[model samples]
Target: MQRQPIAEAVREDIVNGKELVFVDFDHTLLACNSSELFIAACKPSWLVACIDLVVRRLIPWKLTHVPHWYRLRDYACCALIVLLCPWNVMLWKRGAPDLFRRHESRELAVSLRACDPTRLVIVSFGLQWIIRALLSESSWRDTPLVATPNLAGPAYFSSGKLDIVRAHYPDEVIARAACISDSLDDQDILHAVGKGVLIEPQGDVYRAEEHLYLPLRYTAAAKYARSYVLDQFLFVDVLIVIAATSFGFSTLWQACLFVPPLMLSLMCVYELGYFENDMVAARKEVAPTLTAKVERYRTYPIGFGAWAWALVLGLLGVLLGWHFGALRSETLLVSAACWLAVLAVVRAVFFAYNGTATRWRAFFYPVLQLLKYGSPFVLILASLPGAVLVLSQIMLMWCSYLIYRAGGNNKAFNRDVLRLMMFGLGGVCLAASFRSAPVEGFFPYAITAAWACARVFKAPIMRACKTLRSRPARRSETAL
Candidate 1:
């Protein structure tokens, strides 16, 4: 007794008057390497530095498992902080240079699509222009698209998303659909009619009555909704339980007993920051499929070193307590006043820089980009002794990730001030983590110094790349 083949089953289902709605995009309709397109689009910018990071940091492809319905909810639950931050990927497009499109334009434009024998519907919540442009340019124009119509106004991604799908495709007999989407927003599609395909490359062997799937595919709309996909409500239940248990057992003082929480926070921030940055670059399409590898993990033995030093100050408090000194001793009072003044001045200057300048434009702009971006560590530094730094880091990581994601298909970033920003932040965090007072004082000044050094080094790297690109391509002798 041998088993029947899968394709035969699919053909059988289709031939029996089952209206096959090949109702997903990305990996389903258009077949191209999205990750390859993403990286190619983002090339040649200083963001290439992040590429530099990924090249160095890429975990073996073996370990990067594709999260399906079950795992996505687990990941999303842990990413609660990342999700709460505001994202504005829309801005990256405005700032992008036109040259970005030159190298990274679509491969199989709409003209190349084969006619869909089955009814193909592209369900989406992204801007109509974006989907339209991609479709118009691709051979997929003949395929019907059932997305939230924004020919009207700004519709919430969540509000009418399900309604649009429901109104169009009602039952399995009316439409036998094969959903090739990674996000659970299409769980309606999964539950309603037929098979749900995961575009991601790795996952468990999933089974259902009519459903089948592949790995996750990176579509603009699907990527946005990926977390909400599947039986996620149950996963949420598990997370709430974890939160309750962590809260019940872990007091503020006991929080310092181990490194898992802080290390995890740092890992989350590190990944989310680069994730957003890549998304910003790849906003024209989906976010780039790459990671920024940082070696700062090696150097960062003492995160919140400033706070640790403050604890030593508390030891001074203990000595004073033993001697029965007043809480406001003259010497101690003066040190506290000076510390307060330094904090106010630093914060004011940071705000000013963020409001006005880039990291390098007339010196002040570089400072501004630094302060605006690096203000997380500033607040973290200011709110020492408590766990406010962890929360601040969480907020910045999530916010930065969103801003990075909102950019359009283009991945070009203006390199001047933000160039100053990368090292500026790294410098601040490095500084804050140093325990010595002199080292801490020296850290703030390093942002300016690092900006100058980066500007100088950037030129040589460009010259080398130009020389390489200028070399002529070698053609095969068979052509001659």
Candidate 2:
């Protein structure tokens, strides 16, 4: 029998009032079978392999000769053996290069995301724990899955899939639903549905028929460039760099000469830091919460090598800028070294206290943000001819204004406003003081004064805002 295309099968089912779509897990929705990956993660043992071999051999004989509903003893035995292994050992092995590879079919994941979650079901003979773990971060996290349980019952393959379907839906509903699978063993469930879609091993769509044949169209999202430019925050970094250059009163020529190399160097440096952080977290037996998508699997040694490459690229960019006379090479080197030293100290502190209290972490959060978002521009200004010294103060004022606008709570907003007001006054003082003293002499004074004002009035300003907001609410309640 010639198989129809997947799109045609799906349309027929939907037209027939079938809302539910049952998809097989292994080669159907995922790039590879997760069970195989799990087995491969374990240390090779001929004894274990032979045991699994016996189990596989017995599965068919027992299922065919015994009652269809009879418990799959061999399958249960295999699952117990696999799941009982030490989780730590398995995780360590999983980190090995190319040892256990499992990637989902992005095309299928996107296609299913378009459908209602409640209308999707995953039925497979693979281990349920492995399947669930893999889907934890995916769009299908909450979708219903009926696979071979860790320990129990008949295997969820062939006739077993139909059995599970009947348990979940009415006979009429099952008749209207569509089941998608690649294995010929899925024939029983496929025939039970209104329409069926058979996917080839290479992810091509095919008609649900006896033999797999022919190629179809391929679809995949742009992964590499998108991951860096958008997902890794490089786009926002470029915008910030350009905006700062404009604000610093730099000419268009200067901006054109410096922006690309500056952006490239910063992007590489920041990504290197993130890669190193992730590897450190992984080694500490903690999965990193904040990691770049591209550096998800990077190990510490790999990250170190990448960081070295980034340093080289950044140095090359600096050399080119110096050759163009856009910056003083000696000043740039000194300033960058100072900034890098500061960053290294912060990172060392962070790693030393990897599991510090939330309050302590929160205290350092603003400082970290300033380092990550503001340091590059400051270092660049040190080498280039810009009012960088003065503009740094103005940048603080602008950032405070932005914070005021975005502060969710009224008290926070008022506090931010007060900080901005202090910044404005400090800027005025600096402009006046610059005439009497050198910029170097007055710059420290302005920063010191601004810091003193914020420290002194921070609590009082926040308290006043809170009191003001409460008065109106209290008055409304009194009137009621």
Candidate 3:
């Protein structure tokens, strides 16, 4: 009644030359719903949302039966998404269209290839250009497709599919033809055809009349893994770590010796954090990316694997650093022990207050990041390490501000700019003190004191800003 290889079903019951084979595009042939993936990839915009709502509400469900109306609606919807959405072109360039072609069923492809390309027709409500682009990548490039075009014309949807099929075949030939679809909406097409295959959303084919069930042989797990890893961008941090260490020391030898294991360990650490982020995303039911599925990140194999790999690689980096004379053995051992202790304490503190502590954790994360990325430099250059650390921290703060501003996070941008101003003012005062001091007379403690006082005052300013924000809220509550 139902089978794995579609070729077996086609050969056993049907005549490829005489009977036409109609395939539904979206969930039947492709692993994912192209429209869903496209919508997920697009950035949120109020204008686009309003347009989408208007279009959906105004377009009568009954109008799908009409040819020109359906075409116009399809064109309008596509244009609204492309023009009104803030990141429309970027979403497409990021391979929104390629999502359809990513996991084409090999067995289905084989079955379609076995049939006459002309007789095997793609009937879908999916946009024609996108479906054609997807098909062009596979052996089904020459296959005939009946789909919704970009311009106003006849478009296939619901019962319109049957009309397209009827136009392609004579009554005698249609009596021997077959239609394969994934939704109940296509039941009319199934009823009209002599034979029908009901493909479940998971891609197991069933005999429409017999109601047979078959096990699915394919899944998108591996594809999800590849896409998820690439999107996280762990390698960029590895490069930054290498550059930070090399720049700090102003020497390539120690950078070269320390970078390999350091890069590996840093990637593992970042990926461990990524696993945590993905776990939170899953718990929140926010699948922001194609691969943000619970099965992709939440299982013991994936979660445990990241932690174990990070620990092992971190230890390996320390050992390699000591062995290569990049760092002293005793120093590496002490640093490893302290690192473990610090991580345990941080985790305990972070979880103790639950969500309330998250803001503090976020603030400190970049500070800890600066220290971690600069650890190699600290080990190599004992002299002026403080100066290097201070300067790097100042640069990191400003760079983070620029990034936050670009992303439109005004709150973070303002906070980071305040921090940068404090650092800049302190640096100028310290430098002035050093310059003003007599060459023969050697007291720079006064300058250092001024710099320390400037840093200490920064906390009060931050607290004042927080207090100011709360004052308005407090007044409103009192009035209520």
Candidate 4:
């Protein structure tokens, strides 16, 4: 039976000659899926445990063969509803008001309220009872809704929804109507309507605009580029190159002249490795776990532009090095050949690492890190002290990686372990200085010790001072 206000509104809309507007309920009017929320609210302990087991244990094995686990999960939830219809209905009725208030998209709700109530209709694949119960206490109580009739029946989704709309209104009405939805599944209905408005998810908010249905690759190019370039910063590599040059050359002018081009070349190599690794991961279907940022990264398409840019930067670095006397005529050919060989080896290792499955990928990570950190040594082959410094730094980093992995990969724990390792390396370098050139050895010790102490103790000292300050405030409050 049609409510009086909805019937009256429809009659008035027809009289006023306004076209009907259709909006999807889930992820459009609401910020979350209503069916998932219903299942979460009403599922018993046994059902919850079963679902958890399937997700954690069974799903992983099936992921390689069946990527559509979400559809299966939805079917399971619908099956539960059919199995325990009476209990679910009771639970939903009791919880509907609170759930609706918490999950309704306030911005969309406001926009929807501004529309002529008679011309606006809510359409969804969600069960009718659930939708009605959620909207019972809202201002939209009388809004006409076309939804799945029951859990056991076929969902009024996709073409079925179009058929139902056609039955309810004349052909002329649908031809002039507009649809708002977040799903591509509603493309048929969107085409049937005169206009389509898409609700695109951007971080925490949804942006609604005219639907152009752009391809994922084109829409997400900027996001993918940002992820590739900014995800892991290259400052540590910069510092390594600077430290190497300072230890290698006695004259400050020589160090200054050579470091810039060497650093540029190293950066180009790192960027090339990153680009190839990401491309291989994409082809092998080894995507990162689902998150908003990672999802954007996954959409990055293979392109020649990034490859061309990396090659250009590398060539520029080589030219600058030759012009600046870093690659003198006497040794230019040998040095360039060695550098090319090193580049080839690094690229091969990256391909191997990227092609490996996730289960065994960790084993390759340390090797990859070692090659990257050690590659700068090829440019500073003449300095024994610089070579020693670089070797010690690599050892410290490698030990830290081992400790980090052994400790279940907790980031805070890894940081503390790295600091302790740095302190030890500093002490070793300081003692070794007595046997070698004091200035060369002392430089590394000074850098490592100062950095380690500052990072490791800064947090504790600040916390102690904060506690002391808070005690005085608490004492004053007690006296009052």
Q: Pick the candidate with the highest TM-score.
A: 4
**TM-score of each model, in listed order:** 0.27, 0.36, 0.39, 0.43
Candidate 4: minimum summed lDDT over ten consecutive residues — where? Answer: 206-215
Under the 3 Å rule for N, CA and C atoms, how many clashes does model 2 have? 2
lDDT of 3 by residue, 1-480 (tens): 342235444555544456788788776777555444454345543344345546644568454555345445545666677766646756565574355556576556666666667677788777776667666556677888877666534434334567666766676776677877766767767777888777655343321111111000001232245443442223323333343333233333555555555544444444444445445522443233335343432332333433454456556766766665655335777756654454444333333323333334445555445544554443443222234334544465546645653454544544434544554565466557664643422122232233334444655887999889887553555574
Per-residue accuracy of model 1 over 286-322 as CA lDDT, tens digit each: 3345423222122221223323333343334323422
Q: Give me the runs in candidate 2 sitting further than 4 Å from their true place.
A: 5-18, 44-77, 88-102, 155-158, 202-480
lDDT of 1: 0.35
The C-alpha lDDT values of all candidates are 0.35, 0.51, 0.51, 0.56
Q: Which window of 10 residues has the lowest lDDT sum in candidate 1?
A: 208-217
The clash count of every prediction, one per candidate, is: 41, 2, 0, 0
How much lDDT does candidate 4 score?
A: 0.56
lDDT of 2 by residue, 1-480 (tens): 245544543453343443788998877777665555554344333234444545543456554654442235345534655655555245633352232133666655656666667888998776676677667666677889987766544434334678766776788887878777877767778888876777664343321110110000000011134344452243334434443434223333455565555545444444444444444534554333443432323322333433444455456656655555544335767745654554465455454434454324444444544554555554454311123323443454445544543443333444334544555565576566655545343333443344435544756877999899887544555574
411: Cα error in model 4, Å: 2.0
Off by more than 4 A, model 1: 1-18, 30-118, 151-156, 159-162, 171-175, 199-480
| lDDT, residue 312, candidate 3 | 62
How much is 23 displaced in model 2, in angstroms?
1.0
* Consecutive 10-residue window with the lowest summed lDDT within model 3: 209-218
